[model samples]
Target: MNKIHYLMNREVNYTLSKCFLTRLTGWEEVPLVKTDACGLVLFRFNNDFTGLRFKLVLNDIEILTAAHIHLGMRGENGQVVAFLFGPVTRGISVNRGVVTGIIVESDLTGPLQGMSLLELARKMEIGNSYVNAHTENHPNGEIRGQIKRF
Candidate 1:
């Protein structure tokens, strides 16, 4: 292929491979909490899929403590594979806000320990992963949503 054609194809592939989105709700949490708390998370994978940039926005949540990407199917609680917000020393009061971060191989834990970020991406692509947010009132998890391609 010509240089221009190759570059065009590369750009298209990069955009197509990059995004995943999820909508979090208290109802999705295991044991189902009764709260209006909800949120959305967006994951943008790098071109090589070796890492990702994530943005999480929460609404009506209180005393937010932590957020993470867990490895599991919907309606199941799973081990944390990556942290998006603090497993903070203390909960931070929040009504609505955003958390942003980048995750790479080194940031992985639990079942993903020592694995490449691509492994995580593969699991997420298959709907075997989720994003969960925790609060002081629900330390186990206040809200959650399964990750899926955008």
Candidate 2:
């Protein structure tokens, strides 16, 4: 919908590196196979909440196993929106979101000199799940989860 801005607590970086991220898709039930495949994306808001910031967690990750962005509400079968590598997280703003971004601990990148966690977390709404992987054909992801703040 609209866009908002907020800062991260510095803990988000740590949380991502330790968890698996998955996006839910389809209006009906479907199963993903490789939960631990590869090609995890590190997501965040733009420094000014205007755009999205994204990077590959693993530099060696050259393939996309299987990924889909959850669009509908939770528990609902989300559409299978295939994604390669870009600045968007399941169509959600990465650096400039109205809500939050998801990440994997092993794939979580630190808040470097150019990243702003606050502006990114402001408009977070983890309504749907974002499923991801590192291989091209690997249906099941090596890890997946919806980012959360505690």
lDDT of 2 at 58: 32
lDDT of each: 0.89, 0.34
lDDT of 2 by residue, 24-133 (tens): 22212334442322334445543333334444343223343334333344334444332434432232212222223333222223222243333224312443444443
TM-score, candidate 2, is 0.36
Residue 122, candidate 2: Cα error in Å is 8.1
lDDT of 1 by residue, 1-150 (tens): 699997885665554447899999988899888888899999999887677999999998888889999999998989999999988868887678988889999999999999988778878878999999998989999999999999
Candidate 2 whole-model C-alpha lDDT, 0 to 1: 0.34
Decoy 1 TM-score against native: 0.87
List the candidate 1 regions with Cα displacement exceeding 4 Å. Answer: 1-16
